[model samples]
Every structure is written in C-alpha cells, then in structure tokens.
Target: MFTSQEKKGIFSLSLIFFFQMFGLFLILPVFSLLATEEVEGATPALVGLAMGSYGLTAALLQIPYGAWSDRIGRRPVITFGLLLFAFGSILAAMSSNIYWLILGRLLQGAGSMSSPIFALIADLTRPEVRARANAMMGGAVGLSFGSAMSLAPFLAHYIGLSGLFWVITVMSLCGLLLFWLAVPVPDQDPVKATQPIGVLLKKVLKQPNLTTLNFGAFACSMGLTATFFMLPMTLKANGWERSDWWEIYLSLLVAGGLVMVPSTIFAEVKNKFRQVMVGGILMILLSFALMAWAWSSRDFVWLMVALYLFFVAFNVFEPIFPSLVTRLSDAESKGTASGVYNFSRFAGQFAGGLTAGILYHNDLPFLPLVLGAAALWFLVRALGFPNPVRHASPVEKPE
Candidate 1:
C-alpha cells in the first residue's frame, strides 16, 4: 500500500513522533510527585503547571511551525524542532526548582512539530492509503504512551526524574538521527500560497465537519491530561505503591490496544468511519462517567476498569481524528488545517491542566469536571458530525 519512500517516511516520522511523545509521557507518571516532593515551593497548582506548560507553548507555536514548514521544508523545520526539544530536555534535567521545571516544559512544547509531521505524511502518501498511514502514526503515539507509563515508575525508582530527562534528551537526539537518515524528502513542495491565510483559516474554522473533529480532539486531550493530573496521587492514596503503577497501566493499555486495533481496521477498511467515531466518543463519555463514580469509591478494580475504558476510547479516537482532519482538509492548506487541529488539541491540554490544578488546589471535585467535558463533547458530536462518506474520501480543493 506504500511505496519504498512512503514506507521510509512513515517509519522515520513514526519514530520521531514516538521519541517526542515518549519523552513527554515518561514524566507524566512521576512529575507531579517530583514537583511536590523534590522541588521547593511546588504547590499542587505549580505541579499542574509543570505538567502542562509544554502544551501552552506547543499550542502557541503549532501554526507558525506548520507555516514555516510550508515555506521552507519539512526536514529543516523538524530538525530545528528536535534540537529545541533536546535543549528543553537538558534544561529540565538540570532544574533545581518547580519554576525552572515549568520553563523547561514550556521550551519542550515550543518545538511543535505535529502539524509538519502530519502534513508531510499527507504529502508523501496517496489519499486512499492516508488513513492507514495516520493509524500507524497514531499507533506509535499510543505505544509510546503505554511504554512510558510502564517504564516511568521503574526508571524513577532507579535513575530519578533528572536521569529520566537525560534519557529523554538522548532519545530525542536519536529521533533527529533517524529523521535525517531514514525519512525521504518530498519530490516537490506543495503550493501553500494559493489561498490567503485569512481565507484558509476562515474556511477551516467554518467547516462544520472540521470543527466537530477539532472539538473532539480538544475534549479527548483535555480529559486525558486532567485525569492524569490527579490519577497518580489518587492511586497512591488508594494503597497502590508508586512502583506498582506500571502493572496497572500495562494491563489497561494492552487491553485497550487489543480493542483499538480491530476498531481501527473496522473504521478504515469497512468504511464505517462515522459510526466508529461516534462509538468512540460514546465510549469516552462512558469512561468519564465511570471515573467519576470510581473517584469516591476508591476501589482499585473500579478505577482500573474506568481507565481501561478511557484508554480504549482514547486509542480509537486518536488515529481517526487526525485522519479525518486530513481527509476533510483542502490539499492546498493541509498544513494550516493540521495546525489548527493540533492547536485545538494542545489548547485542551493546557486548559485541562489548569482546570485540574485549580480544582485540586481548591479541594473541589475533579472527576465531575472531566465528566461534564465529556458530556459536552458527546453533544457536539451527536449534533454536528456528518453521516456522509465524504469525511473518508480523498482530499479536495475548497469550493
């Protein structure tokens, strides 16, 4: 289904994505603890800030990075982004305080390469095979998330957070090496100046189909980050030692992946994209509801089931959402459209972290907030998502 060059592009890009995402996830299971315990003046809010500051920078820079890639080339932009990411990892590794850690995270996010990566995939693959390519990239991200969760606790137990950051720095450099060595350059740069920036942005934002998918991305990310902001501490309080987190996450993620694989195949191959997407959103809502119920019960089994559902739903949606965005996008402005989509996603990450932090600090309910957001997401999808096969079709120029 893919040419040799296409295979190289997918493999190299997937590796780039895996390394970057793994670096982020490697810290998620332990960063809050590190912030509160090791860093002086680290309040719950600061901990949340440290966890999410990267998203803020990523959200802000996504569009610019995408646009830059369109103007220059994907290789240079990605290389520069990787360099920045590595520098941030080094800074984070050396941080002595919470504030510095936050700065490091912000710098890490500043390397925003998601749009360019996806755009490059769109550049390389035929439309018929694009969804599969996207699924591969999404699978890379899901695998990285699972691997990080499984390894984080053990790594932290031995090398500590600083050492983990150093590891991330090394991994990022490896990604850079892979990018230069393995990924193919596009035969020709796609024309990006055909549409005015204002016009393209307006079109992308105004399309109901695109908007729905973008909102879904936002809600999914928001719920994931917000839940994690509180989950580690909650689990620890519920008698699960930090060392044991890997076991729970590994089991849930594996089960989730098992489900995700078939669902993705059903969506792409069977052409049930809309149905699968709706089912995925409903699954997310159900997961949040379960999480809300589990919060007060403090039952490890209940929490495990809730998270299992969450990961399943999340994995199902992650690949499909971006594929839909690419499919719905005008070929000319795919980079811009992807930028907007990623902006929505990371913006949600920033919001989720802030919301979780405030709720935690103020002694308010967090699960209910996540549940409400999930409910809202469901409503948006039910009312707005189209039923036509248009979303699964090849990319088209805007009318």
Candidate 2:
C-alpha cells in the first residue's frame, strides 16, 4: 500500500502526465480533417509530416532532456518543458497553414519531459510498489486518452481545430502549475555516474533487456499512430459521421478500462509479468489481423472487436513496460534509460504517421498488412524477452 505521501506524489505526477498527453491526443482524431480542409498547401504527404512532426522533435530531444534532468534536477527541466509545450500550442493555435502547424508541433515536441517525469516517479516510489505507481500513472494517461478521443470530434465541431489548440495551451499551463505546486521533490540526490556520458549511454544501449523493451515501446506507439490515421477514414467509409466516432471510442474505453484494472493487478500480484506482456503482444497481433479483415469487409462489428482488443493490449503494455525498465536499469542511468525508451516510442509514432499516411494515399490496401508485419516481428522479439527480477515487498513510509 502507498503511504499518504506516495499517494500525493503519484496523483500529482499523474495529473501532469494527464494534462500533457490529453493536449497532444486531442488532435489525433481530427487533425487529418483539419489538414485536409483548413490548412492551406496541405497535401497527403504534408498531412503525414504535420501529424508526425511533434514525434520527430520529441524523439531527437528526449535523451538530452533526460540527461539534463540528471544534471540540473527534474523539476526545473519539467517546468521548462511545460512552458515550451504551452508556447507551441499557442503557435499552433495561430497557424493558418500546414507549414506553420508542423512548426508548432515540432516546437511542442522539444519539451520532451517524459523521461525525467518517469525517472522522478522511480525516485519517489519503492520498487515493489513501483508497478502500482506506474499503473496509476498509466491509468491517468489512459483516462486522458479516452477523454480526448471522446471529446476531440465534438470539440473540433464546435471550436474548430484552432480552438482545440487553445484548450491544449490551457491544459499545458495547468500541468506547469500543478508540477510546481503539488509534485513532491525527491529527497534523494541525483545518481552520480562514474562513467563518462558516452559510456553510460552506450552501456544503456547495449543491454539486451533494455533494447527489447525499447523495441516494444516503439512498436506499440507506431501501431497507435497508424491505427488512428486509418480508423477515422475506415469509419467514414462505413458511414459513421465524424461527430459519432466518439460513441465508439467511449464504449471501447469503458470496456478496455474495466479489463485493464484487473489484468494489471493480476500481473503484479501473481508475479506473471512476462506472461501478461507476451499475452498483450499476441493480443495486439490478433487485433491487427481482425482489423485487417474488417477493413476489407467493411464490417462494423469486426472493427469494433479489433479496436477493443487493441485498447486492452495497449493498456496492458502502458504500465508494464516502464516498470520493467525501472527494474532492469541501474540506479546511475535511470534517466538515460527512460530517455532511450521514450526516444524509440516517439520515433515509432513519427514513422507510423508518415508511413501510414503515405501508404493510405498511394495504396490504401497495403497499410494494415504492413502494420501486421511489424506486430508479428514484435511478437517474435517479445517471446525471447526476459521477465523483470522480483523485489521484496515494499514497506510503507513512516506516518
């Protein structure tokens, strides 16, 4: 069980994550429409670039951001990152062209606070209960994602994409304020690595466990961006209006959230992390297969099934991966390790949007097949991955 302090820390940090991701995800369902209809000089290729530009910058900067946090402290880095994010949101809100929007996105990604925030979580929580802390964080992110999906289309209809960006700006500021006001500063000093920076990074890169988990992060995020890129279009083809897409997403979110709560507990309590992780990968593979069939047949029922399955699979992965990363990493390089993980994850997001959009415009039929192939490869890699070493049961903090 969490101490009261631990609970406060987790809740505050989770809210920060919620604000950041919620702002970013609010554009997922409606960005394509905004690109096609509103932005001048928008092409299919440009839409893909604009969609992915944030990830590109995020992927490049996460390592440095993480490393900086190790040197300068997490709070300072996180606060600056939130400010950058808000500035970008404001810029994007003002954009009238695709180029400007992409630039805003690129700037937004420059914040790159995920690594430090996660590293801070590791610092604040005990190992045995770390997974539970992360689970709560994942739950916050999941709720934000669900809320974003359920609201995006409806909000876009009423507010326009520009107005949506304004909302994101507000959210970013809220996250900034919450971080300073609520998040507990870790009492522990930063890990002082004896090795050189290059050597430390190289060591992190060489760890088989780290690399495997990194790949998992990449694959999961890639699949997500690609799936969102395709999902709205597929639903449109099946006669669902843009505004009505929220209903499907909301229903699936509720269903997936229910399943996720228990499965995460079972994985942690029963010490079945590897089994749960493997099951999730297989489930993702199966979801792609089902979605492939649905796309071809235009079967609404099958599509819903596939989507729900993906939601469940993703939620399973969300909490488990970071906890595993924390366990697998050494104390000195926790921030760097998380940086690499976030790098891969964001890179995958960029690639997925860019490639999926290209394929969709050039040869729509081949998109799912490509995504399925990636999932298959991910499963093969996951099969050989090792489980995290179990720690002793965590003790609560003193009252």
Candidate that scores best on lDDT: 2
- Segments in model 2 whose C-alpha atoms lie over 4 Å from true places: 362-364, 392-399
Residue-level lDDT of model 2, residues 119-217, one tens digit each, is 899888888888899989988988998899999998999988899999999999999999989988676675755666677689789887778889888
Worst 10 residues of 2 by lDDT: 390-399
Residue 339 in candidate 1, Cα distance off native in Å: 0.3
What's the count of clashing pairs in each model shown? Answer: 0, 0
- As for candidate 1, its clashing pairs are none
lDDT of 1 by residue, 1-399 (tens): 798878988888998899888988998888888778877689888888888888899988887777666666677888899999899999999998888988988988988689888889998887767778888887788789889999999999898888999999998999999888888877766666455666767877888788777787778788778878877877777788888899877776787778777887888787777778878777777777776666666566776677778778878877777777877877666887888889988987887787788775444346555556765666566564664453344563222
Clashing pairs in 2: none
lDDT scores for all predictions?
A: 0.79, 0.83
lDDT of 2 at 49: 87
Candidate number with greatest TM-score: 2
